[model samples]
Target: MSKSKPTPPPATPTPREAVSNAKLEELDQNREDSHGQFLTTNQGVRINDDHNSLKAGERGPTLLEDFIFREKMTHFDHERIPERIVHARGVAAHGYFEAYDNNASLTRAAFLQPGVKTPVFARFSTVAGSRGSTDLARDTRGFSVKFYTEEGVYDLVGNNMPVFHIQDAAKFPDLVHAVKPEPHNEIPQATAAHDTFWDFISVTPEAMHIIMWLMSDRALPRSLRMMEGFGVHTFRLIDAAGKSRFVKFHWKPLLGVHGVAWEEAQQVSGKDPDFHRRDLWNSIEMGAYPEWELGVQVVEEEDEFKFDFDLLDPTKLIPEDLVPVQPLGKMVLNRNVDNYFAETEQVAFHPGHVVPGIDFSNDPLLQGRLFSYTDTQLKRLGGPNFHEIPINRSLCPMHNGQRDGHMRQAINKGQTSYSPNLLNDNFPKQAKQAEGGFVSHPERIEAHKVRARSKSFVDHYSQARLFWNSQTEVEQMHMVKALRFEIGHVLQESIRSRMLILLSQVSEDLAARVAEGLGLAVPSAEGVQINLNVGADTDPAPYQSGPAKADTGRDSALSMAVTAKANAGKESIKTRHVAILATDGADLEAIADLMKALMDQGAQTAIVATHLGSIKGENGQQMLVNGTFQSTASVLYDAVYVAGGAASVAKLKQDADAVRFVNEAYRHCKPIAASAAGIELLKAAAYPGATDILDAEGVVTSDDAQVGELAKKFMAAMAQHRFWDRELKAMPA
Candidate 1:
């Protein structure tokens, strides 16, 4: 008799092996690298001439009988899919999130266990733009992350701004349509600076709070890695004992929050429309991984009604002063996508995608998103089986009684697909709560459903005033300039007048500053209609929001300057791009010394010369040129450094592009440094204290100091990122 085969030992997966690579392994089955392969049709038939389609005698019209041509043309015609109505311009990356410690007391999520690493896919995009729009547009950015956990996929779909323009999802379409280019002309692509948007904002007072953010520097991020992200809606975190606590999600970047000036952003758009996308991709490729800490503000269920603002309101934020964010874990994005369309474009995210420990609150906007996301994926991805797409599939085992639909990828082998079937002996049964099944929190609900909102959501201007009050003087001035630039584009004078009325409700000082720019007076609220969102027959008096006092007068957490100050101790020049302006005969010691100092601190440097290729140093040493003045601009870098040499300074002083570079960097409030003869070049440019500079003037230069000492002072200034104090003395580039 043949010896019976010994039963193989049970296969076991480590904690990291189970969750970190399951999704990637599944996707690997479909991944294909076209290199070293013959070109073939969809059916694996080798092709001859993919460039030219089958035609009659090479010049006549294509023949209908050509099957290969028909197949190729058919596929090409349908290659394009419907872009998202919002967030059409996006970039994504692959990463892993590692928990700091086990917190089963707070959440039973397996991914949140101590030292557990879960793979994640994150996408960042600008709203109000098509797939072809510029990445530097002044708009809200979508910051959505998908965690491939052991239990299931949990999506945290959020935005760079903590608040939204509307309180309810029902009004989302209207808001998008208004912010989009006008239907008649389709002008002003990828921006909200038009008559229709301001007209809609003048009526929707609930949008005032977010409108303030949209008009601030937060709307113009310097890079994708330097901005903060917020979940924007209140969610619930249920413990093992079934107790639920209110939670708000936040993503604080390792790099402190930073933004470009309005004019600098415009220049970046003109020079490189894909500025943010290219920066993210190049950084990851160069091993400079971007990182952010995952934090959550947790509040007890009993304290929900304690805050002056409703926790369910989407247009408000719970100030960190009241409930400080607790650090939970950290996320590091270290990989770029191999194929943009297969992964980044096809990935689907939904606010309703939650594991056992995480749940949702009764936020109107959140509730609306639950239904809207599924419907959108259905229409955009071809059917109900969008989850079967490799990038969107859950890492856990998914099984149900559901049958095949369009684009279904799963195959059930059993005789029965129903739960109570005897043919298959009732296989693939459901799990109990103790067995890792999700059980919704049993919070009692006894009230009847209504079409109206609670009175708690009406205090909209209070948070708006709080945000306006929290900004520093320079930040406030920038906001005023941004408002002037946006509102000045509006052709309707009445829309401008209405915006002034709304601004007055937030702060009279804000309104007056904006009015001064537009050459208009602050409109009176007594005669203006502040509640145009009401129905034709409904009374508008109750919907009109009056100026209310802020719960926390002015939280420092709302100010980027305050955040930068707090992060000063931990700040470094890591991943910062610096421009070293030089030409032939530049001082070799000064260039090598500063470059080495910057590289030692994890900073990146590019030598910008009069031309590409190599430039000769004063000591006959050769240095490679990364870019020329014509190819790279001041807006593309974080700081400017002038390398010292007699010949280099003379050439730079004569080159108009070099002088313009220094002038623009000064105008944008970027750190500028020079050494020895480099100071002569700075004098030729237009900047304050360039003739007789001090270390404190943000223009780091010295006549008698050692090169090492100058490098130290320059790096210290670079750590500050930007010197906003010089903004007031800025001149035209």
Candidate 2:
């Protein structure tokens, strides 16, 4: 076997469309700039008047000869098409993926080569929700991207989580059915905190590892701009020399991974159902584009079995400790979709849509997705011609004999469409590997057809324990609370009892803490029988999980707080939304100094007050308010800053909404800063007692309103994301 080092792969013709910023220019050509253009009909005919359609008279009925109205109305009437079955609710943005260095050594994928800029359309979604569902649901976030590379549109479809619930594709439908609203009532929507879901989790041993992740804080992403995405299954990267190495793909946000508290997520969902959608759109429109670095963990073919767990198992991870992730490139989303229906809703992503160097692994889950994605698009997009959609169309010229689908856009002029024909001079012949044609990695395989899983997949609990041991104390406590909240919603007592036993297999402490919240004792594992009646005819006893090994140690990367706490500089606060609470008679100097510093660091600030328009300072300075008490909430911002003004603070003290804003920010563990008279507001908020008010963990206060020391201290606290150490003493807002 070849060693797992960067080596030149077999040569293939360089693609014509593989030039830097080619997609950006291509997209710009299609962009319409209405600044100096006249209003026109669909056929580009200029219209003298748009407000009123052609009619017999000023008050007469509109005539059928008015084709413009008819065309406009017809298109508007059919604007909406079918949403995706799984990832129905989603938001997408246009960006370019830039390679850091020539990766021709690891893989001959043109987009991975040095300095190549591949245009990309990334769609973030919440699975198990309808097109109108809230973005804050506790479900897996879909992180699918369509990379318009020279070879083709290579789609790297994945999720925010690295692991999945089921190990095989065959169980995908069953898993979805269990997690979705129940067939009888269809009661709960976009959540896994119901009986049917817990029932499935209680019995499926393969779901244990994913359950640990689902119950963690990762599910509650603070912002789409700050979440980490994973390609989940093991894939293959082929060198030009035809050598292949198993690889896992990762997307690390430059802003650092962060998440909101569960309580805050739920409240935000009610207040603004489009929280994530609005956040992403606003950030991009503000020119604060979201960015994520593409990374990979590569393993040699010979070393695939070196790990205790099977690399082919979709429910497992290679643990960053075992194989470190190497950053290869960066993807920045800079543009929003022009039309939601034409682009965001219609883009089809497939794992099968790969470039020359990237190929598929025999991972059961990946194999299933390869087939499912195309089938889904065919049905949902109204035909096999879904790829003809502008968003899905590849930048590279496509010439295939396949034609005439339900919605054929390209009008073929040639009479002869067959191959090796004299009529059309045998046009569009297939190119070889030397001429830019895709060549799959040649791996020798000798295997018998079987329906059984590999024996290596049977050890399911060890890594689960490793993940359990990896979390920080704050994260672990959050997991316990999540389990309690989720399992407590299960109406059936037996389901709750079995889940505790399974949790015990991972950790007694975990099960014991969750059980205490449910007012139940931990069930004995010896007497428990694993349910294997999931439409399968097999012996259930063999599948009953044994206790995890004691050697299952920690993988520090599993903890979000640990990783986030380490990220420094402007990236930590880039595009962070901060709310500055102030009123009339506030010190304009303090507010101006604070806002200027925050904006200079790339953090967005909003002046929030009891009313909109402008508020007057004591020094006769006028300040504009971005939002009013009725328009905004604390859940919308990352941190809160109170500007000093004796008269301003005195008036704000009378308003219940202003007091509640500071209180809620503190309860959420967000950084709170105040200065001079602004200190009165912090005192009126949380833990309002004895000692010093200026020295709290994340609280920054100053008597001087110039904001010199206060700004620096506040910036440092905001970088921390959350003050988890204050969780124990935090009172309700």
Candidate 3:
């Protein structure tokens, strides 16, 4: 009867609805327009058949006269750019770095001033993987951050591990080539467990330090947010008075360093190729921003040589016991990238991108990176003017005489483009030292011109031994298993034999365990030419580089068990996933109370079941299932809970998938709990008989009266993250 039309409902947000929409508005252009519009050509012409191209006739060759077909085909053909040479697979985030105190005492860089927040674009990547490779590849992780400071972009390019595989930059290409897939057939996509890698590393003992780290749990990160980042090179921090201190940069994660089991990492690669990306995106959407504290091991210039190993050595690390890490600032990644390709892929980072007070050291590997990063970006991003890209643009003012190149965004209008000109009154002139000019630290370097590396860099195995001696028994066992897994994959017998001999140089026990896994005897190192002083034909005996000093004390920082101490006392489990396993006839009240307590502590609870959609509850309440057992697995959740109701428990116990879910979670050492009759499900899963799991370790099983207390006890266990000691008891998943 009424001619007036009903008002249209408010437009819904994007798929990631809970994200910071206010920040999204800052990105200019057609996000809103594209959302409600129909598909169109690049020129905005409406298109109907995007699924099929125009042809001469049905199933015939297309004609060049069809503008829509040609445009679509051309765009798709050039859609991809050259992927990165090393860090090909990656994810990025936008964030800000805030200085905790005035680090003016160490560096005069304005970004390090107290309370200054500098915009940052950080990229986390797996080195040596193709763009389409799985994120869980067992390889080095590249952790690079670009701080868009007032002076310039200061990039702290580093890795998850503190050390590197080579001492000199000259050996970098060779190292990458060796670890990459075989030259004959690119067989392995993203792995180092091959013959060529072992063959090259057998003689290059300088890699021993990094080898230990690679085989350890650090290489397999649990989450990008939980990984530790290290500036692998020793850098210099210059003060106002021109005094310099050798500093080792470190990123101490707020969540603490932790990693998934190797078996679980493999499982994740198959179940969810985008597990890490999804985790980070979901965490940010839930308002749980990842955080890390920036710290530095500041060594006085006078004390640089006090340690046995050279501080400038890329393959070595200064133990935390010698110099404690001082927290200078903190970095919080609060936003995900708007465009993956434009921001995460095109953003280039280099060690040379520094401001006033931060300067480079003589680390050979770092020296090479200074030039390689710029060169690679030129080819991959298509030009030198890539800085004009929004994500890579500096937040502060930028003025320079640099003119147009490929893909240039700025149009300069002047008579003169070169410096030292008077026509434009020397416009865009350089700043003086006091006027925020960037001046490299004037370190004295008078030396003979020769193609020779410093002999001080020769001591590699000392720190390698230090790393081995520092690991806990659990970590050490993981390394042993990892080594066996890798060496077993090698096709050549000599490579495996050489590996056994080389590993003996680290530890006899380690060598023996790995040898047993390969079903071979421990090979003798008598004929091995370890390092040989970089092929100079020097005496191989002295070049062996065994522990320089056996009395070196263990460093707690080397172990995740010690580094994760902070996580053990954290108040909440924000962003942690908890799976609520239930079936038809599940108790409605008990499940609701448990979810409330967990949600109050910031843990996300998802109701997982034998099937999707809704499940019938005992109280006539319908429960919305988040996912089904066919879709969700134990590895996806931080913890698991079995809801009560006699019928629900009986049904779950009879279901093999449900039994396996509980058993697998137990096998992975994750915290598990049950309420009332739900304990029967755990018993049906064949839980190990150690103590009454009701209160033993992280497994909590309570009857009806104690259901209220179960939530409290469960959250506390989840905060600790993992119940690692449960690994002592074996169970079949």
Candidate 4:
């Protein structure tokens, strides 16, 4: 017994240890032979002459016994799932939504009840790209949300823009085809600035409004959380009293609206195609939950014609100044999905999924979406049992007589599978209206069957002009720049000229400016018209005409300048990322104190060393470098801090990236802070003198208590987002 002592008892693994062991086991299971192994059939019989595939001879005809090759080819041929026709390239997150206030009077949706927390899944996407395409494409972002309420799932399938390219769903496929890469070459991916896209816009004049929006900064949003979401089509809200009202749903971001410039957007794509996705994921991980306030514009059923534009037109939008959006509740995204394919990819959203009080309007585009979504899921998910997927499944109990579909997850226990059966006591009975069941609003309808669009839907330019008029001077400049860039890419002169003519209908100044940029003359329009048999004289040209007066003040809401800071009173540099440009022998203690104070206020500080390694501080303390001067640019940071020592200043003077970093920060109107030693570095970079340079407005010059004061001032300036008052000497006059 002593000679054959029992082996020591094996130790039980901790949770972390178990995970590590499981990973090791997985690796072991995946281990393959380094040297070539004998080829074998499915039945484990080794084959000596595998290359011959059981043929009669090396050069003779192959035999039918080569089942291995046949099976391999069969699996290879069927290794793809049908991609979503739209929203193919998408990123999704899991979150929860809590209503700020009760919206029972508006709708009886349980999720909108005050204090009721409902889990939500949101998917952001690019419309035209395939599932495998890059993320940072110049395209509209689909902002769709699925709310798993106690009642059922409510889907708000919307886009970043408030309006769509087409008003009618009949033209949806055509629009998508035109914007998609040309079928022959498939040269471009996730772009609309091509011959086919321009050609489509040239013919469809009604697309002008959305085209203008697409060409603007909105299409290149800085972040998904910074953009607004809208249910482009009008829908109906039926109250408990059976009172129906025409409504438009809107999701206004708490961060306010912001966008990246075209040049920056392009550069970001190459630098990081996952820039937006990473920003969202990191922000959520860091506890900066994205939030949006839900608002709705309600119009009585009888007052639908009160607006100058048709409410049913998907291309039209009701300006907030006109009817005003009544704030309903707020939605906060506080979670991230654990799995992409199992959750994000498998989740399906349909506009047809409405609760008891929500109903659809007569918007033709919406009517078509109702049919298209369910049809797409059947093919994309491989069967009708997609609802069984965890992401798409409703939390509420579901019962139905239908069963035995492909990939069915549930097992029916009862003998009866049909409704109205006496066998199972008819347990799954239909719910009545009193039981919070869905019911379509009954309304009188009388119209001749026709394929033509309504006369009211023809006006496309007045709102475009209104939008143009409302923009601030800076926004208008950006819009002009956008127009020039998009039209400049047009290879065909006819397409450019046609677009200019359409622009002229929006604004004469805009048309002339764009025409001048393209080196083309603006063409006079003969006034296009759409024929409708409504017996009323409807001229589409009048709709294409710009507003009589271009001073509507709608631009106030359109411009980000007006909505930059959510809380004006509490404006501080909290959460702002500041770049500290430093080198060896920099003011370590002062920099440390400033950074600590910033971090205490929720700000993030990153040290940009001359190189990517440990840098010696002024006190001979080594600090781990966060980034290099060349790798991290000033454009990526909110503010710049220069705390150089004599040695560091001399070293920074020779570095071009260090010089450019300070200069670019100045050019972008960001706050800059410098110590006495840092001033010489700034002078070497030829930074223009500012009032804040010597005065304690934003810049710091002293190493005393004034340094802390200067840091506070700079932080306040950073919260201002931008300093437009700084003169732009580099701009062309």
lDDT of each: 0.84, 0.83, 0.79, 0.73
Candidate 4 or 1, higher lDDT: 1
In model 4, the worst 10-residue window by lDDT is 50-59
- When 1 and 4 are scored with TM-score, the better candidate is 1
Cα shift from native, residue 11, model 3 (Å)? 74
Q: Write the per-residue lDDT of candidate 1 for residues 96-159, one digit (tens) a residue.
A: 9999884677888788878899999999999999999999999999999999999999999999
lDDT, candidate 4, 1-733, per-residue tens: 3688788855987788889999999999988773666555557765432211222332122233456434432332233366666788888888878875757787777777778888899999888888877666777889999989899999999998889887655456667778888877985778877778888788777887887678676787767877898999889888778899989999987766767556556656776677778778877889878888888989998898887788878888988877788877778887888988888788899998877888888776676566557766877797889998999999898888879889999777888888888888886887899998788888656443333455677677877877787665555666787788777877899888888877887888989988888888898876643222122333334334333344444645655655564443455455467898888988787778888878887778999988888889878998778999767677567678888577888898889989988776665556778876888776666544543334323344555533677677666666666543343333211
Query: On residues 416-486, what C-alpha lDDT tens digit does candidate 2 reach at each position?
Result: 77798877777878788977788877665544333345566767788888898999887898899999989
Task: Assess the local accuracy of residue 370 in candidate 1 as a C-alpha lDDT between 0 and 100.
Answer: 72
Worst 10 residues of 1 by lDDT: 52-61
Best candidate according to lDDT: 1
User: How many residue pairs clash in model 1?
Assistant: 0
Better of 1 and 3 by TM-score: 1
How close is each model in CA RMSD to the real structure? 18.9, 20.4, 17.0, 16.7
Ranking by TM-score: 1, 2, 3, 4
Count of backbone clashes, every candidate in sequence = 0, 5, 0, 1
